[model samples]
Target: MSSPAIAVENLNFSWQPDKKILSHCNLAVPQGEFWMLLGTNGSGKSTLLRILAGLLTADSGTVELIQPVGFVFQNPDHQLVMPTVGADVAFGLVSERLPTPIIQQRVAEALGAVGLSNLARRPIYALSGGQKQRVAIAGAIARHCEVLLLDEPTALLDGDTQLDLVKQVQHLVKSRGMTALWVTHRLDELDFCDGAFLLENGRVVDQGDPQILKHRLQTTTV
Candidate 1:
């Protein structure tokens, strides 16, 4: 198998001494594949994703992930800063200091990949929840991020839009050869992933085929 694009070894985290969020958690995502993180509320799924994105520090553990990593929060409103779709996508590339031409090319390509090429100039408020998520993804694509960490990205969408967004991410990961780790509670979304990991009590108790995990989740009470 390819070397892991995202890996955590003996990860441990806690908000206070009385409780542990993640306990000796260990998991890995293979290079260029899309994987899902499954867990109930407070399962430390989001916490783990945050640590992988360097947004949070683990109390004890080793996190080795490919860079530059792109993080997509649960709400696009929290990350999309520009007024327009294209501008927002390009905004992420500003830090790289690339030439304007390069930025335009990237923005065009990223938006196109997400099927938002025609909405480049459209106001962010006019877009649907799914579109907003796509625009957020375009931002990462524009930056050419090697690894994508998504924390419940489809949580705010309807059933159709939720599945659509997950499908879009699956396509992006396979087509672009980018590694992605998505945190989701929807079992239907598992059908679109290459694999999945089940996080329980901040520890990974299962990891493997998406269908199997989906089945397990369906039959068990998280």
Candidate 2:
């Protein structure tokens, strides 16, 4: 069998050393599979995604990422640092010192792929929240990552922007054939995924197809 895109075994983490956020977590994500991480606020969903993205290391147990991961943070402000849209998207490739021509080609292709080709020369701050997120995603694609991770990716956007971002995510998974791990609290967004894991109190309390949990939650709430 092909190697999984990501694997975690008996993982545990704590920001304050003694206050654990993730406890004995075990997970494996196969290549090209999309997963939605559903959880209430402060349930460690973001923490787990951070660990998988190589931004944070678990304090105990094993966490392994088999594929290059591109992370789109919840807030685009943190990711958009360069002055221009093109510059921000080019940051990932430029750091590797690729030939200038190659970097330019990739930047153009990535921007064009996300429908932001027209905004390439525009200043980063001039773009709206959704546009910034798209640029961040374009940057990740330019890096040639096989897996993408997101944390509450649409929490700050308006309704239309949120829908556009969802379509963008679908394009990333279907067209690019990349594995995606989406973390979100919006149950409606869960339909955008095939499977989901429900988290509570920093633990995975339930998991399966998103539709199943939808029914379960509705039934219990009723």
Candidate 3:
């Protein structure tokens, strides 16, 4: 088996010493596969993703991931800072100081991957919820990120739009050979993932086989 692109070993975290968000949690995702983290609200799903992304620190345990990593927030409005789509994608690459042509090429390719080729010039304000999420993902692709950590990227979208975004992400993962860990509650979304982890009380009690995990969640409240 190939090495995992993302791995966590006994991760633990808490807001207060008594109120734990994660507890000795362990999870892994191999390169080129897409995985989802499932749990009810306040199950520490978002906290775990933040720890993996290095946005937050774990009080105990270790996190290892392939870099450069790209993070898409639950709300695109919070992640997209530029006025337009193409510009926003290019913004993430500015720190690299690449040549103009290289930046443009990367931006174009990323936008194309997310099915937003025509909306590069579109204002961020004019985009639909799903389109905004695509732009956030394009920013990650523009940087050639090997790992993607999405915190419920489709949380704000309607049903059809949610499935569309998930399908597009599945295609991108297989075609680009990238690894993705998505945090979601919608069981239908499981159909697109290679596998999933069931997070309960900050610990992963179940991991593997998306179909099995989906059935588990469907029969019980996540």
Candidate 4:
């Protein structure tokens, strides 16, 4: 069997010595699967994503990642820096000193994967929220990252756009056979995920099918 895409054991983290943001957290995501990290605000969802993406280090324990990760922040504006869609997507590769032809090919392929091939030259400021989000995703794909980490990616969009963006991302991830760790509070999004983990107070309290977990949450709330 293939190795898990992400593995965490006895993970612990804290911003301050007296307060913990995550405690004894453990998780494993198999390659080519989509999983949701579900939790309320301050539940350490974003913190977990940061650790997996190597943006933050755990104070203790282990994090084993089999492949490089690409992070998509909740705000597209925060990830985008170039004026045009194509330029932004190529920014990361340019720093690698890759041949011009290779960089151009990668940029084209990434934009095509996100269904933004026609807007490659469009100005970023003129794009809609959904379009901007797609641009951000294209940048990640250009990097050829094996794992995608998303933190509340749809939080800033309208309801319709949020669903559409999620569907688009789902299709892209499956087609590329990439592992995904999506952090979301919207329960409806869980229907499309292969598995889910529920976090509360910085620890994982449950793990299983999305439907089963949703039912559990609903029954407990009533």
Candidate 5:
């Protein structure tokens, strides 16, 4: 059988020597699968994603991943650097010194994937929150990463926009056969995930189908 897209064994992390963030955390995502990470505020969800993305080294434990992972931060502004949408999408390819024709093609395909083809030339500042988020996703798609990691990607959007964006992301993940690990606190968004894991005080306490997990969370909460 194929190896898992991501695997973490006995992971541990802390900001300072005394304050622990994650403790013996373990997770596994199969290739081409999408999983939702559900946790309360300050539960180390973002920290875990950063670790998986190679942004932060864990204090202890192992994190094995398929190479070429794409990370989309909670705030689109953090991922977007170029002025125009198309330019930002092609930024990574440009850094690789890819031929101009290939870069243009990739940028176009990425933008189209995120439904931003028409706004390719639009200035970053002029786009709405949802549009900006799409631009960030397009940049990752342009890189053709094998896995995508998203951290609270819809925290800033309205209800309708959040739903729409999640649907688009879900479509992209399935169509591209890419693994996605999405961190979200919004219970309604769980429906879009193929599986779900719950984190509490930095440990994965429960996991299973999204609906079942949601039910457990609701019934057990005080």
Candidate 6:
């Protein structure tokens, strides 16, 4: 049997001892699938993404990630830490104790893939928000993760940058066969993916094609 890219079953979690946030969640993501996780605010989208990324522990459920996973957080500041764009992109690999030459090659390749080669030596803090987010993406890509989790990636981006990011995400899914789980409140972002899930109150209320889901979301909002 082919291993699922990610699987969650009867998952439950809570920040506080008495207050439960997620309740009896079950999901299965297959290899190379592009999935969009949609929800309203406070719907546990970010929390679920964190759980899949191995950052948060579930209270009492099975959460399995079959391969190395990369995460681009909602906040670019949280991901970009090094002095220069190149350095920041290389930070994760360096921590893994990769050889210096390999690290250098990976860093250059990652930056070039993100169209940030010229900005390799540029200070990370000086770049525009969109550029900083791209650097974060490059850093994640450098990890060569089989699964990529993005939490509200476009919330802080302008329209042009948001569209660009979606295109890049599509490219990654096609070329790398990387499974992506994107959590976002914006319905506009769902059009790029093949399937989407609507999450509300910590539960998956609907799941289907992007166009159908988009229409449902609009109707509910109206």
Local distance difference test scores for all models: 0.94, 0.85, 0.95, 0.91, 0.92, 0.85
> Which candidate should be chosen as best, given lDDT against the real structure?
3
- Residue-level lDDT of model 5, residues 1-222, one tens digit each, is 889899999999999989999999999998998899999998999999999999999999999988788998899988889999998998888768899999999999999999988999999999999999999888889998889999999999999999998999899879999899999999899989899899999999998799999888888884
Angstrom error of the Cα, residue 63, model 2: value is: 1.5
lDDT for 151 in candidate 5 is 94
Clashing pairs in 5: none
lDDT score for candidate 5 against the true structure: 0.92
* Clash count (model 5, backbone only): 0
| lDDT agreement of model 2 with the native | 0.85
Summed over model 4, clashes come to: 0
| Candidate 3 residue-wise lDDT, 1-222, digit = tens | 888999999999999999999999998899999999999899999999999999999999999999999999999999899999999999999999999999999999999999999998999999999999999999999999999999999999999999999999999999999999999989999999999999999999999999998887778765
Worst 10 residues of 6 by lDDT: 19-28
Between the candidate structures 2 and 4, which one is better when assessed by TM-score? 4
Better of 1 and 3 by lDDT: 3
- lDDT for each residue of candidate 4 in 1-222, tens digit (9 for 90 to 100): 988899989899999999999999999988898899999999999999999889999999899886667889999999899999999999978768999999999999999999999998899999999899889888889999888888999999999999998888788778999888899998899988889999998989999899999899888879
Candidate 2's TM-score reads 0.94
RMSD of 3: 1.1
Candidates 2 and 4, the one with greater lDDT: 4
What's the residue-level lDDT of 46 in candidate 1?
98
* lDDT (tens digit, per residue) of candidate 1 on 1-222: 778999999999999998999999999999999999999999999999999999999999999998899999999999989999999999998888999999999999999999999999999999988899999999999989999999999999998889889989999999999999999888888888999999999999999999988888788865
Error of 6 at 152 (Å): 0.4
Off by over 4 Å in 4: none
Q: Could you say which candidate leads in TM-score?
A: 3
Residue 1 in model 3: lDDT: 88
lDDT tens string, model 6, 1-222?
688798888889898988767878777677888889988788888999999988888889898886788899888998788999989998888768988999988889888777889999999879987888789888878888888899888888899999898878878788778898888888888889978888777777788788999998899789
Candidate scoring better on TM-score of 4 and 6: 4
